[model samples]
Target: MMAFSSVTEPLRAANRVGGKEPYSWHLISADGEPVSSSSGFALLPDFAITSSPELSHVFVVASIGVRPDRNAPRAIRVEASSRSIPHRPR
Candidate 1:
C-alpha cells in the first residue's frame, strides 16, 4: 500500500474482516521519512516509493479537504499507478 497519510485504521479493519493478510504491507513516503496527517496523526514509512519494489496495489488514503483546501496532489495519484500499480483510496 502506498498509504498516503490517513485511513490506516480502516485499512487495517478491512484486512482483518476480509481475512486478507498482506504478504507484506509496506508504508512509503516521498522522502523516506514520517508524514503527518491533517487529523494530527503521524506515519513513519517503511520505504520511499522510488526505492520499493513494484507493488500490485498502492492505496492513497486522503480525507476530503476543507472547503478552502485542495485535493491530494496529482503526483501522488500518478505515482501510485505509473509502475503498473493499481490504486485504491478510501
Candidate 2:
C-alpha cells in the first residue's frame, strides 16, 4: 500500500502543480476482484491479470510474505509468461 501511495501521491501532486493530469494507475488482481494487502486490508482492483489492459508498465508489488501463487494465480502467471509479459521476481 505504501508503494502504491508513494508513486500515485507524487503523480497527483505533480498534476496539482502542473494543472494537467499526467499520471494514472490501475490496481489489478489475479481474479478481477479485491486483494488483501499485507495488513489484511482489501484492495479492489481495476482489472484482472487476464484482461491484458493496455499499459506502459506492469508493477507486481510483491512484499515480504507475499506468495507468488497468491499474488497471481499459477496458471495465469504461466499464461502471462508464455505471452512474454516482463516480470522480475525479487
Candidate 3:
C-alpha cells in the first residue's frame, strides 16, 4: 500500500495544483479482481492484464506476499519494465 500510494499521491497532488485532471490512472490486476494489499485492504481493478488497454505506463507492483526469486511468477515481474521500476527486497 505504501509503495502504491507513494507513486499515486503525487499525481493526485498535481491534479489539485493544476485545477484539472491532467493525469488519469486505472487499477489493474492479473485477473481483473480485487487485489489485497499488505494491510489487507482490497482494491478492485479496472481491467485484467489480458484485457488492458494500450497504457502509456504500466506499474506492476508485486505484493508483499511475493518472493522476488526465480520462483516468482514470470508474468508478474516483467524484466523489461523492471528496468524502470526499482526492486527493493526485504
Best by TM-score: 2
Instruction: Give the whole-model CA lDDT for all candidates, comma-separated.
Output: 0.61, 0.74, 0.71
Per-residue CA lDDT of model 3 for 1-90, tens digit only, reads 888898789999999999999888988776677877878898899986656676677766765675454422453456425444454667
Against the true structure, candidate 1 has what lDDT? Answer: 0.61
- CA RMSD of all predictions: 6.2, 3.0, 5.3
Q: Sort the predicted structures by lDDT, highest score first.
A: 2, 3, 1
Better of 2 and 3 by lDDT: 2
Pairs of colliding residues, candidate 3? none
Superpose all Cα atoms of candidate 2 onto the true structure and report the RMSD in Å to 1 decimal: 3.0
Q: Which ranges in model 3 have alpha carbons more than 4 Å from their true place? A: 63-90
Which ranking of candidates, highest TM-score first? Answer: 2, 3, 1
Question: TM-score of the candidate numbered 2?
Answer: 0.72
| Candidate 2 whole-model C-alpha lDDT, 0 to 1 | 0.74
